[model samples]
Target: MKYHVQVFVSLKPSILDPQGRTVERALSHLGHENVSGVRVGKLVEMVMEGERAAVEAQARALAETVLSNPVMESFRVEVRELAGA
Candidate 1:
């Protein structure tokens, strides 16, 4: 069987994200006063097979190398079983 995984990677809390702050400021300036503390992140989804451990390792490697920056970001992976190929 194959599984689908969703990986979410976000900037570390200690890191300063000017892009996110700019977006938040723009929102407030545009009259979205209720919007607060917006943070930017990345999402990656893929399908793979094999033991859970192996699949998770593969996903993490991809996340660390291609999808996220280890210096300033953290990532998490969510796996779901699929019924079809």
Candidate 2:
């Protein structure tokens, strides 16, 4: 079966996010003072064939060990069975 995996990677709380901070500053400078929090992340979607559990594990490992930096970022994976095939 085919599974669809969605991976979300975000900077760790302790890590500095220059892009997010810049955007936040811009927002405040634009008078949106109520906006106090900003975070930046990346989303990756892929289709693969395997058992749900195994695929999810593989995907998470790939994200943690290869696609993302564990010290500076965290990752989450979501898996769902594909339909119509």
Candidate 3:
């Protein structure tokens, strides 16, 4: 089986996000003051071939140990089977 996996990596809420704050300031300068607390994150997308359970497990493991910084960042994993597979 094949699975589509997405890992979203972002700073933990307790941490400060300089890039997100920068973007928020930029947006306000562009006349969009309504935006607040804009947080930035990275999305890692990949397709892996494996059994469903293994794929999900691997994806989550990767997200936890590799894709994110355990001290200051958190991650979320999403998995889906490809359509028409």
| Leading candidate by TM-score | 3
Candidate 1 TM-score, true structure as reference: 0.84
Itemize residue pairs with steric clashes in candidate 1. Answer: none
lDDT by residue for model 2 over 1-85, one digit each (tens)? 8988899999999888999999999999999999976988999899989887889889989898987889889999888899975
lDDT of each: 0.89, 0.89, 0.92
Error of 3 at 1 (Å): 0.7
TM for every model, in the order presented, reads 0.84, 0.89, 0.95
Model 1: residues with Cα > 4 Å off, grouped in runs: none
Best candidate, lDDT: 3
Model 2, TM vs. native: 0.89
Ranking by TM-score: 3, 2, 1
lDDT of 3 by residue, 1-85 (tens): 7788999999999999999999999999999978999999999999988999999999999998988888999999999998766
The count of residue-pair clashes in candidate 3 stands at: 0
Task: Tell me which of candidates 2 and 3 scores higher on TM-score.
Answer: 3
